[model samples]
Target: MGTGLRDRRHGRKDGGGADGRNDGSIDARDLLTDEELGLIRMEEIPGKLEEIKRALEEKVGLGVSFDLVFRVMEFGTKRTAFFYANGFAKDTVLTDIIVRLTHLDREQLVPDTLSSLLNKYVSHIQVETEDDFDKAVQFALMGSTVLFVENSGAALVIDSKSFPVRSIEEPDLERVVRGSRDGFVETLMTNVTLVRRRIRDPRLKLEIMRVGKRTKTDVCIGYISDIADPRLVESLRDKISKVNIDGIPLGDKQLEEAIISKGWNPYPSVRYSERPDVVSSHMLEGHVIVFADTSPSVMILPTTFFHLVQHVEEYRQAPFVGSYLRWVRFLGIMTSLFLLPLWFLLVQNPELKPAGLEFLGPQKQGELPLLIQFLLVEVGVDLMRMAAVHTPSPLSIAMGLVAAILVGDIAVKTGLFINEVIMYMAIAAVGMFATPSYELGLANRLVRMALLILVAAFKIPGLVLGVTVWLVALSVTRSYNTPYMWPFIPFHAKALFSILVRRPILANKFRPSITNPIDKTRQPVE
Candidate 1:
């Protein structure tokens, strides 16, 4: 494949130095096979209209796939080949473009036919010329109509991408009582529009670039030009451009994993948000957002432990109410992480219980050990969670009832679990469910399990060691150069105070120091 590509380049009269450019020494390009080389499509557009037509049919599966539509229409004396994806191309838009093109006379199709067509005839809001054949193919696959003019090196790409989109409804995970009901849709353009609509400022930059060799997924990086740190934006862009992958089937999730280099760390380095309002708020705070095509969720980078714990619901109410809610959430998160292990420790070492808190120790110790009982319940809860997801919507309530009433009652009756164990575990499970970020909740669950094992093996010291390790790891971990435990490990008193207490919107005059934003303040404060 390398040799073939080189031969094509060498054969082209326009290709300079492809013939005599270090022919002796074996280059690294020689090692790659056809599949390994990301560029499978022809790099240079074939000069002749017939060759371009043939290439489109052969390479892009024009005739093979029902959706990939190809047609040769006469524009004056010259013939033009049209490549468009059927479902993606808007029928009305493409028809209007073609109808407008049919008006060109034979005399009009003279020198610079492609230019004349683009400037005078093909009327569209978004259109561009593509010199690279592979890129042109990608454009066509993305639902744009590519016009291959006879003997022209560049193809006239008409942006007529009209993807099938779901109605903009509130996302299931990030729903709030008082907020915009419309959340981000799967469409990249629509998602950008949603964000853009909220922030009408010209400094709100949304730079798009395609990633994935096979999928060629569209990725949009959004940030306020004046507010966002240029260094951070550039760093993130470089990392994303360097992502070497065949496809991003899982969209933002896969892209996040690829760029972040998160090996075994269960904790999320970046925050994911489906709510546009939430995203806009983050952008204003000088955080950069990554929007991936075919994904409803977008990634907010330079995230911290507190970022994952936060929710839009807190801000929906009064400032004091929001602060109260924030503290409650903080408590819930801590409860999820420590409740199980602390309960286990107390039951294991009854002497550790305080004088008045004698009831904290389990009065009922069944045949099973406390550790085994906790582990069983943990696994059982996970199983039930998975089952709930797969189960039909109508049956989910019934399934939950069966698990809570039937399973729990039976297990307790059969001595598989003690009453105190079930009660404590239930409280811990509720706390886990209260977490805002799903990824963070899951990560906390892993930490909870680790803590449980540690407590079981080494008691008090094990729990301490587990927590210390978690904190130390977070202290060391960086998300796009921003510390994972920012404002806490480094101890930023002002920032930490603001995070702890959700201040009024106008009160938050300054942006987060973690992002190193160019503009420090949102508004002037007297």
Candidate 2:
């Protein structure tokens, strides 16, 4: 129940005055209590070892090997000694320790002697002072074995840490044909190693922060110390320190809850991606990255609206292709939001239609209001979408096509809703899926309904007014204090080329202005 040690200087590698007691000289007895001492398995060491072996069975439980050995040395001979580890073959690093233990003087043995040998010989030994059973179990679970010696007050703990894990592989979610294929794994240490390999500068700091009350999930904050804004980094740390949750299964939800001020809004406040290249690019630009253990995705904060529309693969590909895709995406987004509702308003409200397109309307006659007819179509589309996502892929596609085409044809033929209105609604419903992020697509769908209502009430004037308000909101929002509508509304002519259409890596001379990194330029020397 006691608070864990909080002196920030304790974990430092330097021989500083604050951590003078951390010279591996402190007695193990001084740190442990009698209750904790009881958990030490001196008498039951053999039995417990058997229990562990029985549990692990035929698996690669190589670390669970514990056996009794006799040591004979020049000073004296010991009757019994404990050897616990899985992979200590004749060629193993600990094999020499087994051979040397045979000659040690039994009468001269002290708790400190065993502890000193461990600190000197073992690769990663940690001594726990807490006597709680749960705490001891946790330490063992992490691949460390605790040794209890008979007629001794202090227990000797050795770091026989070994566990089989998958090698680093390319991330599945975020893929680029041209970039590095390496991806992060569930292990915190492995993830850190991956980042360190990319950015070797000492200034690239990785500060560890643990979230979740019980999950104790390790979260690392990565940022360039010299390039990053000091205030932003500190603020990010403060927010992370405050998160109190039972569990955080995924890093995105936990970080979103912690840092986002307007999470309730449909728009994303933080940018998330699984690519290390994208993350590295963000860190170079003064943005802080929040990486959660066990999650492949990393969160970069104060993200602007424009960042959502972008993909890292664009820069890696050809410029003309990137520009075409960007324009197509833009057109698709506009159509998704306004196409159906605007069509309904133009076709139904005779006062709002422009000169040319007015003649294409009303193949079917209906007494129902235009709003009512459009609403029915919208509801049907939503049901189809839900069914599609829940059902098998092939079946879902068939069902969606059948429901949209056959059902609409039947409804129009029966004069249940206007034929022109149903066609317009179908066009808009299909267009809404153009946004890459599923959540973003859903947000636009919801917003489209609001736009439709406005158009229904005031016709074209209402649609214009609603769109203006939406643009104003986007312009005001900040991504890590940078303008959300960067290079567009503010008009960065030189930088605007990359936003509207991505250019080659060499063509980009300036780092993204939105990142606000300490170093603004990112072009290689010719």
Candidate 3:
């Protein structure tokens, strides 16, 4: 039998309140640090046990169990016994332990044996003290059973946790036509296993870290041991270890900023792709991968400017077709960015046109400069985009239609702006959608306008200078100390074939050489 007794609250009113009150009534300011406070204990063992139970009930507002006592039976042995009426498990291991100790006697019991027995039978371990009541309650609530024992100032923990969980499925964002369909889920352990299953080499390493002060997000860095450069891995580990935040709401983005060399640049130094195949491809290339606990997107380091322009679809198909598609992508990028601006400027700026091309559109009736016309058209297109993004998905299409056709048609006909201006802006707007990632497309759309402003202010000379400076800055940037513009500035012959014109996978015999990868080959064994 146990008697629940409340211990006297002896700390100063100004001290750290057990229930989070700090009204300053108790002069607890200098009594002891929490480290020292956790070591204090009362001389009376049973009384202390009762006090702990009472405190737990008061603090957590839950049923406290302490009735069963330590039993000494006929055979020179001892056991702590409790009567559980929950009908949890009749043949369970815990039930079996309770039933087997019937003939034990007190003579067999010793301090060392008791410690060993508890450790051998218990499923969980937790250190407990009067000061750590809150933490103990948290563990108990998480499906751990807590035990308060007399004479022993600690609590016995039993793991009996069960929770509903979903089975893993192929990633929705990264569907493939002919590869393993398995993908990472929201679970951390499962994600690690997915990667490990693909790379069975003993040298493959998965380094884990806990970030997010509140979310406590689990992040894993993976690389091949014999294949990954040690210095690069160490540098990556150092960066991830330094991130301290309340919570990383966007897990992939959080890691990107941590490892990104050009954090301020609009061009993404780190590429995030959902497909494990893409990640594995990057890993083999000596690029480091950062897997966030929550987001399915894996951040691949040392990603170059050209990688964003290429697609996984190219590698899935034939070599000649892939090269043709890569060239098409280059053209698409040009169309997406400069098409509208050039179209608008050529038709509107009479000064830019050679004599015969002046017949392109209505002779300029307005006094507004070409720059002002572009700015106005850009603003109109932006308003339409903003409305589309914020509107409901079904309604977005309607909003887009209205903006593109209704308002735009009216604006042109009434001469608020030239029809050519609307046509040019519309082309640029469509071109922005050519990139795979929505975020990257949005970035290019923005940079194109800045490029437009330069061209409008100083024509082709200004455009050339802006593009040159941008490329120069990119060449200097590094991701995890690996060059951002890989295979381009370093000028790898094979990489140029793969990047600018993606060849057949068979022809792509060598991995990206600019990343200074530990291993330089990714050829599949025949």
For each candidate in turn, give its C-alpha RMSD to the true structure in angstroms: 8.2, 8.2, 11.7
Q: For residues 285-308, could you state the per-residue lDDT of candidate 3 as single tens digits?
A: 777777776776777766677767
lDDT of 1 by residue, 96-178 (tens): 98898788888786888888887878888666787878768866776778888877888888877778999999998988989
Model 3 poorest 10 in a row by lDDT? 1-10
Candidate 2 C-alpha lDDT tens digits along 1-526: 2222322212133321112232222222222222333564532222233443333333324344343121212213322233233332222434454555545655555445545445543344344422333443344433445444332333344445544447777776556678788876666556656666677765666666566755656676777766777778777777766676766877666667766666467776677776677777778767888778677677876576666766666666688887887777777777888887677676657776778766766765687777778777778888877887799866877886798678878777777887677667766765666565555667788788888888888877888898898788878877656677777877788777667777776777666666566667675365
lDDT for 244 in candidate 3 is 56
Better of 2 and 3 by lDDT: 2
**Once superposed on the true structure, which residue ranges of model 3 sit more than 4 Å away at CA?**
1-185, 259-263, 344-370, 376-389, 524-526
TM-score of each: 0.88, 0.71, 0.70
What residue runs in model 1 are displaced by over 4 Å at the alpha carbon?
1-51, 75-78, 108-113, 130-132, 150-154
Each prediction's total of clashing residue pairs, residues at least 3 apart in sequence or on different chains, is 0, 9, 10
Best by TM-score: 1
**Ten residues in sequence with the least summed lDDT for candidate 2:** 15-24
